[model samples]
Target: MENLKDEQQNHHQPVKIDLSGSSFWAKKGLKSLEANGARVDVYWDFRQAKFSNFPEPSSGFYVSLVSQNATILTIGDLKNEALKRTKKNPSATEAALVSKQEHVHGKRVFYTRTAFGGGESRQENEVVIETSLSGPSDPEMWITVDGVPAIRIMNLNWRFRGNEVVTVSDGVSLEIFWDVHDWLFETSGSSSGLFVFKPKAGFESKSLSFNGRYGDGEGEDHDVEDDDSSPKYCHVLYAVKV
Candidate 1:
């Protein structure tokens, strides 16, 4: 887990509870900790968790973050289990997933999933990135969402760094920025591509920042008051060729 930081810029070290290994106490439990002047209760059970290519579990487990007798954040598919163990009702305002970073390794294709929108309208969408860097044909790339091709870049050599706005639902859209210069120009085998996905709205006042040339563009920075009506979320994926 990453460190928790509040809006006041105070950093709180995360408490780690190992749920792995053969130890009998490592499977399920509840932990109480204090952070930023608040009591946080963590309830988790991973005895029958399932995983995929990622290190995080994919299903069959529950990790709930409770505070003030309310569940704020819940992971995995066992929400009901978490509620039962925590003995707390879901918070009126659930925690927002502000940002996520994932590293995926593949040769020419990379896959991931992310949820867009918030509240009742939120929906998960599958993202598939396919690249053709070498062959008789010119280098090209295709980005698909929910098994549908959403964005296609032809002649990737000239368009290696670009941004596109893709529509995910009727009234939901996201801005995608990609930088693959390292994959094309760098001779190092450790080269990887960067892709950023952010919702079209809510991020106007405070957008995700990147360290590369993509950060040098105009309108990347905004100074405005924070709006609770529109929550911000961002997903960053690093595709490493292997």
Candidate 2:
């Protein structure tokens, strides 16, 4: 396993990280949450964030904090070369329009509902800020908001919005939901119920235990194997003081 120092040093490079999509979102979302409370800034590894097991480009979300109530934002590939077409040629059929931009923690988060190909409907990357106001950290969530097969949220105690459901995969399963505004601990059951996440003081710092599912880049297959599985895995994030 690579040391934390090494990981921190080369975080910009596309390293094989085993973080879940929701976790990535949570960490990034903290920027917005923190912004609501204090000064904050956020940065994401665009190059690595675009690397996924599926297709070619990677799709995901990341957040940053700039102030106690201000956040800078950018989604995976939202600012990439792909979206240049939309800026130049704005078309209802060819380009996506802003779905909505609401103020979360004083920052305006812009979400765009876009359709690609013919019936292949999906949400395009959203943007929240221009320049980063904070540094970078490991992702808390990394699932494609609109382009995956499945994700299973075994236990979720938080409230959520967007596409809030799990999609089954051939070999792996993904779960993307917030613990509402709480933390989750010691709960497991069916794949068909609202599993609430309760809060704990140090749950975030408590080392994660993926059981046997995690492999440290020593040659492990952690990519989605099938398409047409589940498309949306949405979760909402809220800040709770420690």
Candidate 3:
């Protein structure tokens, strides 16, 4: 966020971003999939990523595009300090980010609208790119820009990793296996409210009439938590499948 117009995607703040071709994030396990004909990249743009809130409501936290071994890119404080709006950058996140539009699908994912930036600059919302993750694997993440599908991670075998996380994706579809045995039931009061992204599925991608409508900022204010522990809050996911 330091220089919005910079060509390189580097946020030179406490939370740094790696723009070098050799990204800090690891893609070791992903090679086999590549051998099987899947695309590869040094860094990954985490779709609809969430961060654990800092102690101070204003002082925010950071999230990274990390692999099993290293960190790739990290966005410092996803919110705008001056306007209290979400931060967005297409070149950094590798998604064509647009503002004031709805459901820009595929690689053209929408980040939050630039509420308090310089001029009234909002990326066009008509372009679409072909971006996908590996297939035949569990889902690592399910991300959407506005109401349009963005990126999804697959084959992320975190079951044995043992950190209370489960993510998998396959470029096209996504599946998530959660192991919050410790985070849920055992805990209370904002216990399960550590995540943001509100997920709701439509009837089907083909049938707009029956696929339901996607409202703007529908899930923006979800789990509004200041911290992750010692508080009282419960997170709920409203997903509708047809």
Candidate with maximal lDDT: 1
Considering summed lDDT, which 10 consecutive residues are worst modelled in model 2?
A: 190-199
Judge candidate 2 against the unseen true structure and give its global Cα lDDT, from 0 to 1: 0.26
Q: Tens-digit lDDT track for model 2 on 148-209? A: 42332222222222123332222222232322111223123211111111112121221222
Off by over 4 Å in 2: 1-38, 41-74, 80-169, 173-193, 196-242
lDDT of each: 0.69, 0.26, 0.26
Task: Compose the digit string of candidate 3's lDDT tens values, residues 20-92.
Answer: 3344254221111131253322323233344332111222433333333333333444423211221323233
Best by TM-score: 1
Cα lDDT for residue 176, candidate 3: 16
**After aligning candidate 1 to the native by TM-score, how far in Å is the CA of 115 from where it should be?**
1.3
Q: What is the TM-score of each predicted model, taking all chains together?
A: 0.62, 0.17, 0.17
Residue 171 displacement (Å), model 3: 13
Model 1 over residues 47-141: C-alpha lDDT tens digits? 98997644566679988888877665676678888887777885443344466667778989999987655433457778899999988999999
Off by over 4 Å in 1: 1-26, 29-43, 48-60, 64-93, 118-121, 169-171, 202-209, 213-231
